[model samples]
Target: MLGILGLDELTERVYRELIHLGPSSVEALALRLSLDRDRVHRSVQMLEAKALASRNAVGQVQTAPPQLALGALLTAQRHALGQAELTAAALAEAYHSASTRSMHDLVEVAVGADQVRQRFEHIQLSAETELLALVQSTPEVVEPGQSFAEEEAVRRGVHYRVVIERPMLEEPGAMESVLGEVLGPERIRVVESVSTRVLIADRGTVMLPLTESPQVAEREGRRLDEVGEPMALVSRAPGLVTAMLGLFEYVWQRAVPVRLADDGLDAASADSAPTTLDLRILSLLLVGSTDAAIAKQLGLGLRTVQRRVAHMMELAGVTTRLQLGWQAHERGWLS
Candidate 1:
């Protein structure tokens, strides 16, 4: 029974013999059992480590005789182990809760950068449907391991969309190559603003750099790496995801659409850049503004706000209102 329970066979044998043979010195125990003195001493050491035996003043080992108290000691050990397990579980829950809380709720020192990256990676691998990203750095700076495995994942029907800043497209390296290869002019959208790094997966999870301008290219590669357990929270609350999606749409509507016209379109005000009216509509929506309020603020019909929001969702490739919010925030659509 002890063997089945993971006890070493030799330890079990030694323990049983000690129980049956009465308290004896190591030499006596070894001679009686026909085992090496060194082996007997080592087994005695193991028993001492577990508090199952003791050593006398002369450095001789003594096994505790089995008694009613032995059962109590075993029970105490089981209880202590149970308490340790529970404490560990509780701490894990607390850490996850702290990680998900907003910046307002964060009182502790900033977590290590590696910890944040690992958490983000966990979100990426577990994505079920779509991955909406607002990239602050080049793709090469994010996920350098753009291996065939990732290509295989996309081949298997993953919806991968990225809203990149203008500076990255104009610059060189993996960012330029990735944009040309994966996004291209037709597939990409440009948000012309200083961006915070954001990675959202399947609408269920999100990862972002806690810093205003994360040195993502210098520190972490393409993707925000994941930390801790796979399912653990990598950033602020899930509610923030809604805010970010709305913000992405807000930006997408105003952002200059990238086209495949052979010549890149020049960014100019004459091109009907987003005006103050667009900004007002975004502000209203971010504050949970109803269609009527948005229209009143922007001097448009209630139907207009609805139509624009719908169009924004289409541009961002999201379905529901909440997803739109997440997309918006991810793309720096809002302030």
Candidate 2:
């Protein structure tokens, strides 16, 4: 029972025997436990160190009163724990400094969904400035309540920017749920497709799946299977992180922004703009289709599609195509 205070089994046994026998000699304890005298002597020394036993002037070992002895042991244990906590704090600081110096060796390979999720939560909690994520598909291994960490991070002022694929928004109330959980719609963007799943923090650390071929992953943006064990790569390499930042920025520019109704519009007000044809164009834009692709899908000329898009942008009072999409959604044109 007192082993937590550094008492070995033999010491505890001898101490109990001494307490029971009442002021016993080492030989007597050895005989009672069927242990050798030398072993019993060693246990006495350990018990003395723990303040559980003491020696009189005649060199006879005596067990201290259990009340006093146990109390002293508990106090010593508390003091030791306090010191250990201080030492741990100092060690953590040193480790952080060393990790910063060893960025090249920071790349790690984690196997299975649990490990990937754990790494993601750690990165989010450690983020100081901003977080950028390209979510192509949801992993099936999400632990219950794990999303609370992300919500807390956002509340603490970590600038979060997530680009989600269009297909994920097809689920009923999906957009509403995301907007409610995150700070607002401005933090999210939608793309027709995402090439890969990525999470980058502070432009210093990057993480992505390792099981898929990079080229195929980028080209197809396939969903990860729920039953499959996924592997991920985490890195803090400066050059690699820089390249990832560039990729995120490129996608961010082309992606359509999501504007929430709460930003300033009632349901009726939002449903007041854009004709059916303009709504069709906005739908294609939401899925990340190009002007030519939009024209081909709607059986219209490329120039005609471009002209309509430009007119919508003018009506929405936005300069960029992506911003136009945001306004269309804001006005409930694509709702």
Candidate 3:
């Protein structure tokens, strides 16, 4: 209907009369449509505003070509409708994806420090069964005890597992405080190095940096903190969670246990134990150091290094080096 194009009945009739009569005076148009002259003049003015009609010097209104005028309006509206259709379809796709809990909701980006901090706390507080951490910083620097919510998470019987890299081990008192006080030594492990920081809760949700490390970014000549605040991503997608958990497991299995309490008892080593020198020797061995290399590093005789290793194996009741490594880890002797 022409009404859909912003023309009411009287305005449309006046336009139609102009088209039919070629050109007509306002008074004649009003007489023919049975309308007052003033109303007809207003309709003609509206038609002129819409470019559907105009007056010549003689003051008679003439219609523009219908195809050029109304056709253009129709074409513009069709274009607008097409754009609206695309928007609607996209919204519907998002709605359906959300309703099904599909992979479309894979990564939720948290930009800026406040958002990243909130996500970090959310993952820790929302954990139901287990909390796994991959920390590159000192254990105490990451989160310490009297560990407020961390203690609360522990109280809820949430299993906490932490793996720290060598950089963390280099920190003073890195192992004696924080998680040590809250979770004990058995919950902690250490590896030669960890690629990045990750916090996973119940293998269900993960919070991690949005991009790779600055070292990685530097290869492309971009700084990670160029935008001032770091960004983090939280994912609840099942596949992503499983993949992240797999990565954690891969790192955890190879990590040796930390000695949280300097005086803690080791059932395997209680009678004749590995001393500070012995633990250092074991730490070197875990990094693939030979007996000769271990002796040189620790200023001990090669025989002394070999004897300490052999004695440790005997204390662990293990016959092979591999089994001894496992047993030493179980007894929490390595760094």
Candidate 4:
């Protein structure tokens, strides 16, 4: 029980023997503890230093009162703890400094769904400025009741911009729920396809899948989904994060804006008339500009260009890009 007071095993045993024997000599303690006399003498000297024991002028050892000795030990322990706390703080600062100096060291791999989710939640909670993501068709990462953290982040004025695959948004009531509870429709977009999943925060950190290729899975005679456990790579390298931000910008530009009914665009009017962005996209399309070229010409994102084109095609009741171009000309939309 008193080991917490910095007493070693032998010291505690000798101290206990001293208390039990009451003013016993080192020889008596050694005999009682079945320890060597020299070892008991050393323990007695240590106890004396702690003010727990004293040697009389006749050379016999005497123990201080239990209250006095225990109190002194407690005081010593508190002082040691204060010193340890200061040392720990200094060490933590040094470690943080060293970590900042090495960007490569900031990259980490998390395995298993739970670990990935935990890392994702940590990043979401820590985000202060902006969060950008491209979500593909994957297993759901956010479990029920866990979205409160994201809601808190949004309440703190953190901007969230997400581009989701169109098919994922097509789930029953998913779009409405996301718009109403998670993020506004203006900050979200949908794309026909996404190559990979990605998440970026404040242009400083990124998380992406760490998966094996189909060839490897085939060689192992395993289906893609059952090949191995899921993993994610998280990195805080400035250069790598910057490149990811560029990719997100390219995809965001080409994605179609998801306007809700309350945003002032009725289905009837949307089917008949084009939005300003849609008109710009039509003008670019009429000039024979590819999606990438249109995005570059108008300083829009590639995904935005593609999304507007798709929206225009839907409005014109055309099934193909070429047919939409012909419809635009026939309806005097090109003029």
Candidate 5:
């Protein structure tokens, strides 16, 4: 563990035993630790060079106080890390600026996985109201349950409106990440499929991927096959953002809210609007079509049609199809 502080294993062991033994000679340390005297002597010398150990006139080695010595080492490491962070931030800004043709434009295309990941995280941290996203399985920057910024945003009470493609939550670490303390089922809905990955922060800005990148491919150890580098289009352009927002809504309505905390229909069913398929099925039923007929017309399985009809009946608190139709009319479901 002390290797990170520049202490080799033997050196750290020697120092720790020195502290325990309290003023041990090299010979005594070697005999007690079953190490050669010369190796113990060398480690003690190294410890002394680092000011972590001292020898008395009689050549008995003793460790420096643990608190003082380790605190100094840790503080120096932290300072170095802080400097590196600043340098990295500068480098990242340069990378992003280089990728964009004009920083003044409302929309700019940026290359590199790092830039895209940074924006993905930065938007979460910057959100003050709602944050919306459609997540996919691959080309992931932030792994599931690893988005610290998202956890912070959730803690800030920012409402999340997120949709995950059906396969995404089945991927490894996906359930833990999306269902971890950072996110709950209440904020997430499942879609049959989503082709594009998107993020809309506060509905004011949208980020969309444009291509796979060599940087990401190499990082993931995948063959690039001469594929173009990963790139993302970020936009604050009102028309583009609005169109993206509309698309999000369209998909969101068709998606099914999920709940696995208990055995029952999704609690979201109480508040969520009827899905597009649900509306189409209800419409066909009201027009006096049989379940099989509706199924064939909608390209759904016959059993799927029956199941949906039963679910609608439950939602309407009625046991019969006729009552369900009457309830649908009362609720303005056709509209």
Candidate 6:
């Protein structure tokens, strides 16, 4: 058989003898095989190199057990395997937690105007110590029963600081009166500009329309016409929440404190008047209401509104809506 594989017959014989007897000294092995001691020793060395056998000191030879350990090998393998499984489970858990945070931490679409109002109510109700808000209006365009919610929130003793457009201060209504009675003169601050509406609650959360097109309208009976996706250019990350909070601080710094009864003439007149048309255009822009809406609200033609806004933008030296809003506030025209 060894001849067919091209191996020496003595080499084959030594291999068979080692299998029958587990371990043996070189002299005993040589006596049993009837081969010279040197030849037996050489055969053992070849078997050991092939990993079929092993040698001990004092010239004893033994059959090498299988490379695989039974229980102990399995235990070591399982310990390594268990570590990998635990690591994978941890990574999966972390991914799931991050997905949940992304979904819950930011603004989302509310179903209806009523639903939007409800969300605002919920935010107001959830306030702990203070509420700082920047929006187009002071009283806010609340549905019928929201006043009760505001009253309930006020009763809880939350400090409310707000910045609003000048027209909202002039509007005659129970809503305006209610704000005056509750928040008092000290809490209300007003600024002027043309931009989208933004409302911040307790310096933690913010609400802004994500739509780039002004044509997209909140359809009747549909509160959420679209999703409130986070601004990609701006960091909505938690680490930058303080930066957004800083924006409110900057606006608050430039805003003027006022009471509904005060004519705002004192503040408005403190600086030289920017021509009546400039004041009108600047006021409309600050409220986040569009040019057409402002024209309709002020009873002017659309073209006139557009021309006036263009003129105001050129005069104010601002390139973007956000900057325009901030500039209008800084100039104290919206107040």
| Model 2: pairs clashing at backbone N, Cα or C within 3 Å | 192-287
Per-prediction CA RMSD (Å): 18.6, 16.8, 10.3, 15.1, 23.3, 11.8
Residues 164-199 of candidate 3: C-alpha lDDT, one tens digit per residue:
765444433444453456665237777877877888
| Best by the lDDT measure | 5
Off by over 4 Å in 6: 1-87, 94-116, 137-147, 169-180, 194-196, 201-239, 261-335
- lDDT string, candidate 4, 1-335, tens digits: 76787678999889888788778878888888899999888888888988899988888888899897888779888999999999999999999988866755779988877888888888889999888988764434553224666777788888988877655543334434554555642276667767777889888999987874344567689886775766889998888898899999999887755533334443235655786557655654653457776676556678877877888888889999889877876876634
* Tens-digit lDDT track of model 1 for 308-334: 666666767889878876776777664
Q: Ten residues in a row with the worst lDDT in model 6? A: 227-236
True-structure RMSD for candidate 5? 23.3
TM-score of model 5 vs. true structure: 0.45
lDDT (0 to 1) per candidate: 0.58, 0.74, 0.74, 0.74, 0.75, 0.59
TM-score ranking from best to worst? 3, 2, 4, 5, 6, 1
Q: What's model 4's lDDT at 195?
A: 78
What is the lDDT, from 0 to 100, of the residue 20 in candidate 1? 77
Q: Report the candidate with higher lDDT, 1 versus 2.
A: 2
Encode model 6's per-residue lDDT on 1-335: one tens digit a residue. Answer: 63433336777688778768867887888999887999998887776765666777756687765343223435655788899999999999999999887865553565444555666677778776676666654222453224565666677887777766555644334224535455542266567732545555666666544343212234233344353422312123554457667777888787655433333342123223355554654554554557766666545678877766665566678887678667776877645
Q: Which has the better lDDT: candidate 1, or candidate 5? A: 5
Backbone clashes under 3 angstroms, per model:
35, 1, 0, 9, 5, 7
Q: What is the lDDT of candidate 1?
A: 0.58
Q: Kindly report which residue stretches of model 5 are placed more than 4 angstroms away from their true locations once superposed.
A: 1-105, 171-174, 213-223, 260-335
Q: Model 2 over residues 1-335: C-alpha lDDT tens digits?
A: 86898888999899888888888788888988999999999999998988789987777799889998898879888999999999999999999989866854778887886797788888889988898988774443442224666777887888988877776555434545544546542267778777788889988999988765333444576653522566888998888899899989999878776544333332123333555565655765777667777676556688878877777787889999879867876776644
